[model samples]
Target: MNPMIRSTRLALAALLLTALAGCGDKTSPQTASSRAPSLSTVVVKPETAHREQVWDGVVEAVNEVTLTAQTNARVLELPYDVGDTVAKGDVLVRFTDIEQKSVRRAAQAQIASAQANFRNAEAQYKRIAEVFSKGLVARSDLDQARMQRDAAQAALHAARAQYSEAGQQVDYTVIRAPYAGIITHRYVHVGEAVQAGPPSPQPLIGLESLKDLRVTVQVPQSAVDAIRNHHHAEIMLGDGKRLAASKVIVFPYADPKTHTFNVRLLLDGSHASLYPGMTVKVAFAVGAAQRLLVPVAALWHQGEMTGVYVVQGDSVRLMQVRVGERFGSRVEVVSGLAPNQHVATDPAAAARYLSSERAEPKA
Candidate 1:
C-alpha cells in the first residue's frame, strides 16, 4: 500500500471514533436524567392513632311509643298507615263517636236543667229570708227554703262535672299524634272494636321520631369496662360515613342471661335521615397507639398483594404492607414500612419511572 493512503485511512478512522465518543457523552446525561426523575414523596412517621374496637349494633329511635286506646269505641277512620309521616297534632285515628256525642248532649241538657232549678230555688230562699226578717214568715219555713236551695246548688255542681267528663270522652274518640313522627306499625284496621279497660289496653299504633336516634350495642363483659370508661364512640353507616356520638350511655346493669352490658350511643340531629332497625358498625375508641400512616393514594393493589412505592435515594421500590383501618385520606401501616422512610405520594408515577429504569440497557 502507498504511505500517504495508509496515513489518510488511519486519520479518518480516528476522526470517526472521536465523533462516536462525543455523541455517547451527550446521550448519557439524558439517560441518567430519565432513570432518576424527581418524584413527590412523603416521610413516613408514627402518628397518634386511636385503637378502635368495632361491633355490630342496631339502630333505634329515642322517642318511640306504642299508642293505646283510651276510650271504648269501634274504629271509624284510619287516615295514616305504616311508614306514613305525621305532623304534630295530626289526627291518627278516629273512632265511631255516636255514643260519645249522645252522652255529651245528655250531660249538657242535665246541666241546663240543674241551672234552672238552682236559679228558682235561690229566688225562693231570698224571698223567704226577706219575709222572715220582716217577721212576716216563720223561721222554720225560711230554713226549709235555704236547705232546698243548697241541694239544688250541689246538683248543679255535679252536673258540671259530668259535662266535663263527657267532653273528655268525646275528645278521646279522636286520637291525635303527640309529636311529629313516622308510623311504624298499625295494630288495628278500620271497623275493629277496641276497648279501654283494666285488663290490657288495646294498642292502636306504633310511632317513632326520626330526629332523635340511638345505636344500641350489647357489648361483651370483657369490653364493658373500657367502653364505660372512655365513653367515646362512632357510628359507621352503610355508606362508609362515620358519625361521632353526642352522648354515650352505658347501662348500669348487665344482662343476667347474656352477661353483656347494654350500651346506648346517642346520635346528633344531623343524622336524622337514618332509618330505624338498620344494622350499623359501632367503633368504640378503646385506647390510643402509635401507628405508621401514609396517604391512601400511595397504595398499589395488585390482585391480593398490597404495596407502596418507597423512595430510596434515586430509586423507587414497591414494598408489601399490612394495612389497618382507613382514617379519612390516610391509612394505617401495620407492618413492612419503617419510620422516616420516604414514600412516593403518587404510586402510578413511581411505577412508570421504575418500568423505564428497568427497560434501559446496562452500560
Candidate 2:
C-alpha cells in the first residue's frame, strides 16, 4: 500500500474515536450538584415536638336512637320533621288511641264497681266481727264475712292493675322523645301505618344528642397501653383546629376479631356544625419530646413510600422519611430527617429534578 494512503486512514480513525468519546462524556448521567439547578429550600428548624400517635376517627353522639313504634297503629299526627329539636317528653308522633281510651274507661268503671263492693264488704265484715265477739253472731257467719271482704279487696287490686295498663296503652299511642335531641331523619308522615316493636314499624324518627358528643376510636391492641395511660390528648378537625378531649374512656377488653380496643373520648359541647359522622383525627399523647419538623408540602409521596429532598450546599438527595402527626401546615419527622438541615419546600419541583436525573443516559 502507498504510505500517504495508510497515514490518511489512521488519521481518520483517530478523529472518529475522539468524537465518540466527546459524545459519551456529554450524554453521561451526572450528579445534581454538577448541574447546580436553582431550587426553593426551607431551613429545618427542630422544635419542641409533641410525639403522638394519630388515628382516624369519627364523631359520634352520646345518645342516638331510631325511635320505633311501640304499637301497630296509623300515624294520627306528626308534629315534627327532620332537623327539629325536641325536648324530653315532647310529643313527636300521635297515634289513634280510641281503643286504648275505651279500654281505660272500662277499667275505670271496673275500679268504681270494685271500690263500692269493697266498701260494703268492709262494713259488713266489721259489723259481723263486732257481733261475733259480743256473742251476737255465729263464728261461721263471721268467717263468711271475712272471706267476702278479702275477695272484694283482691278484686280491687286487679281492677287497679288493669286500669294502669290501659292508661299505659293510651300513653303508648303518643310517642314522645326520651331525651332532648335533634331529629335527623323522619321515616313516617301523618297517616302512615307504623308496625309495633321487634320488626319495629320502620323507625319513626332518628334522634341524636349532638350536645353530648364523643369520638370513638378503635385503637390497635398494640397501642392499648398508651391509650390507657394517655396523660393528654387532642382532637384535630379537618380544618387543622385542635381541641382538647374532655375525657378519655379506654375500654377494658379488645375485640376478638380485630384485636382492637374501643377508646372513647368526649368532646366539649359546641354549637358548631361538628356533626356526628364527620371524619376526624385523634392524637393520643404517646410522649412529648423535641424532634425535627417540616412542612407537609415538602414531603414527597412516591406510592406508599414518603420522602423529602434534603439540600446541603447546593447538593440535593432524596431522603426517605416517616411522618408523624400533622401540626398545621407542618408535620413531625418521625425519622430519616435531622435538625438544622435544609430541604426543598416544593416537593413537586424536587420530584421533577429527581425524575430528570433518573432519565439521564446510562453508560
* Winning candidate number (TM-score): 1
lDDT of 2 by residue, 101-138 (tens): 99999999999999999999999999999999999989
Q: Write the per-residue lDDT of candidate 1 for residues 1-363, one digit (tens) a residue.
A: 899987787677555433322312324311223345688999999888777899999999889999999999999999999999999899999999999999999999999999999999999999999999999999999999999999999999999999999999999999999899999999999999999987988999999988888999999989988887788998876554578899999999989999999999988758854788998888998888899989988998754457787776655566778897777667788998999999889989876775576567766
Worst 10 residues of 2 by lDDT: 21-30
C-alpha RMSD between model 1 and the true structure:
14.2
For model 1, the local distance difference test gives: 0.84
lDDT of 1 at 107: 98
For model 2, state the Cα shift of residue 227 in Å.
Answer: 3.2
The C-alpha lDDT values of all candidates are: 0.84, 0.80
**Stretches > 4 Å off in candidate 2:** 1-49, 187-189, 195-203, 255-259, 269-271, 291-363
Residue 234, model 2, lDDT: 80
CA shift of 141, model 1, Å: 4.0
